[model samples]
Target: MILAKKKQRDFHQLSTPWNVVFNLFAGIFAFLCVFPFLFVVIISLTDEGTLAREGYRLIPSEWSFEAYKYVFQTGDTLLRSYGVTIFVTVVGTIISLLFIAFYSYAISRKSFKYRNFFSFFAFFTMLFNGGLVPTYIVVTQLLGLKDTIWSLILPLAVNAFYIMILRTFYSTSVPDAIIESGKIDGAGEFGTFIRLVLPLSLPGLATIALFSTLGYWNDWFNALLYIDNPNLVPLQSMLMRIETNLQFILQNSQNSSLGLEALRNMPQDTSRMAMVVLATGPIIFAYPFFQRYFIQGLTVGAVKE
Candidate 1:
């Protein structure tokens, strides 16, 4: 009994120090992570004039809805951009998930003789690529994807990392007995995949879908590279234009007595912060819905088979 009590005391002594250190580290990291977002939120609500005069602060000296009002005054542009973003997110996520699921499922099946060959073919692109110029030419000239929404959707639809994650999940989580049972039930290859395999892989699919959707939502590179039409601009690209180039505001602010120079000198710093909030709003709002799936799927996929 004395020996057991000594061991228990030692264990508690060691664990107490370690727990304290862990809690201290975790508290600091959590504060660091949340601080920037809190700052942005505070700044977005701050009066532009106040922010310009006082600079940034954790607490706003003067609060105003002017920034939000400016963003929503017309409402049409924001609405249209939201629609474009939604369309891209939904369509891109669906197409990407489908292709990735089918490909991963194929590669996971041991009976598929050419699985490794196909996987290597896919994996090879990750290490080497046809450089930017050639890729641009192929996407624009050969595929004729330039100046179109498809330009954004097609190029990023299949991420190698996402495919690999899905493949790993399938190989480990899915039992061979289940596939054999499906086969014995006279389920066709495609049917079994669509009916059985897909249902069981919901967590993995949900994880990849959220990631792909966020990618499509945040993508401005494809728009900057290929798209020129204002009508086709996704929310992120539109936000980029609004933030970087003061010309859009100047052009629209024609009704105001302020000249281009004065408008250019307006509290643009605060407006830029406001625009950042606007650009990221939807994704941030939608994130919690899939956050659980993302954590679970990534954790499961990261474990060695």
Candidate 2:
């Protein structure tokens, strides 16, 4: 009894120092990660004149919502872009997750005769591809997806790395016993997966969902390359256009009478930071919702049994 008590006491004493060190490191890491975002928010709120004269500050002497006001002044266009982006993100994420989950599960099954072939096929994609021009030609000329919403949705729907992660997770976390029992109970393959496998793989699903959300949200290059219609432009693309227009106006200041004033009055610095805040605002709220699963999902396929 005494020896057990001493062992318990010694374990706690040793663990206490490690706990303190971990907390300190974690605190520092989190602050380092979050401080830039906080600085962006502060800079966005700072008055343009003060921002120019005094530079960035943690606590600005003067505050203004002029940058936000400027952005929303063109709210109709911005709102339309918001709608486009939201639609793409929601729809794309759903389809991509479904494809990833189903495909991964299929390849993970030991009974599937062609599992090795399919696995190699998926892995081959990660190693080599047809390159940009050929892909562009196929998407534009052959498939005729250019300037359409499908162009955005289809291209990014299948990610090789994510598929492998899901496959490995399903293989490791999902028990063959449960699968056998389902077979014995007269459950179909699809039914067994939907009922049992999916529920058990929530952690991996949530992690991939978060990844897909961010990818869809931040993607502007796709819209830039494939889309010609202004109505179909996503938020990030629209913001890029705004920045481009500002630069254009500044560059041609000497040519137009109004250009000088436009250059002088452009909310250049503050507006950039404001755009960051706006783009990231929704995603920031989303992180906490997925935080629980993220830690769990990262361990996918790492531990056997």
Candidate 3:
């Protein structure tokens, strides 16, 4: 009865006029946030002639699919790069989440014999690193991961910062009594972690998963350094190469009036927007699936005695 009364009291605290003002401002804020991407989509659909003649517009007088058409022209290469990127993102995010969870969970436990030592071990790496040349030699020479997908995955798989975040989250958000109870129920370390701890830690795990997913999706430098095979090139690397080649073509074009007009007709600006849409659309859609867990993870053990 008190809980229901508290809920009712809170609901009435807003007042109708205040609620209207809050919602009005929130709607405007949301529109402002979303308008840039909408503008990009409109630009991608605008005809090259219209774009060149007029500046960017919310509604173009003419529309064309030339940008998308050009992107799709390399159908086989596009599909292959897309497959490689998806595979890398999925596999990398899973591996990253598992490693982070285990390492963080291990270090967060006060009962662990080497908790402080392992905690310092991860922290020490955050302060210093063997420079790129030496690190490169290790991966390429010692590990023989060069020109392989493992090179991409292994390079970025473990982040010290992510381990720290998960460790803090686990410490503050998981109560000791619960683990004792699980132990009392005859659960082992792995069993208690899987059955009790993981269920309560979804929000923290979800946050890390989203970060890892974005890191893998947008990575091109790793592909540039480690992947030499054409077939192993991921989407971002392929897109970078496409943009570079396009710029080269534009630079070497004829320098005359007709040539300038031809340049105007080419899908430079529009193609960029098309690429932006293609690259970002999937990740944008993915954010909503993880949104609920990100903040709610903070509240996990708040009510515990």
Which model scores highest in TM-score? 3
Candidate 3 residue lDDT tens string, 1-305: 99999998898698889999999999999999999999999999999879989979998999999999988888899999989999999999999999999999999999999999999999999999999899989999999999988888878899999999999989988899999999999999999999999998899999999999999999999898889999999999998888897797688666677667657667999999999988888889989999899768756656654
| Candidate 1 structure quality by residue, lDDT tens digits, 1-305 | 99999997887675777889999999999899878877887898888888878988888779987767765654687788778888988899999998999999999999999999989988998899898899899999999999988998999999888888899989998889889989999998998887888777888888888889879988988888998887788888887766665666666777766665568445566666777888776687787888787777657646453
Q: Among all windows of ten consecutive residues in candidate 3, which has the lowest summed lDDT?
A: 296-305
The TM-score ranking, best first, is 3, 2, 1
RMSD values for the candidates in order, in angstroms, are: 5.0, 2.7, 2.7
Rate residue 125 of model 2 by lDDT: 98
Query: How well is each residue in 72-182 modelled by candidate 2, as lDDT tens digits?
Result: 777689999999999999999999999999999999999999999999999999999999899899989999999999888889999989999999888889999999988
Name the top lDDT candidate: 3
RMSD, model 3, all Cα superposed?
2.7
Clashes of 2: 0
Misplaced by over 4 Å in model 2 are 1-6, 9-25, 298-305
Give the clashing residue pairs of candidate 3, or none.
none
Candidate 3: residue 295 Cα off by (Å): 4.2
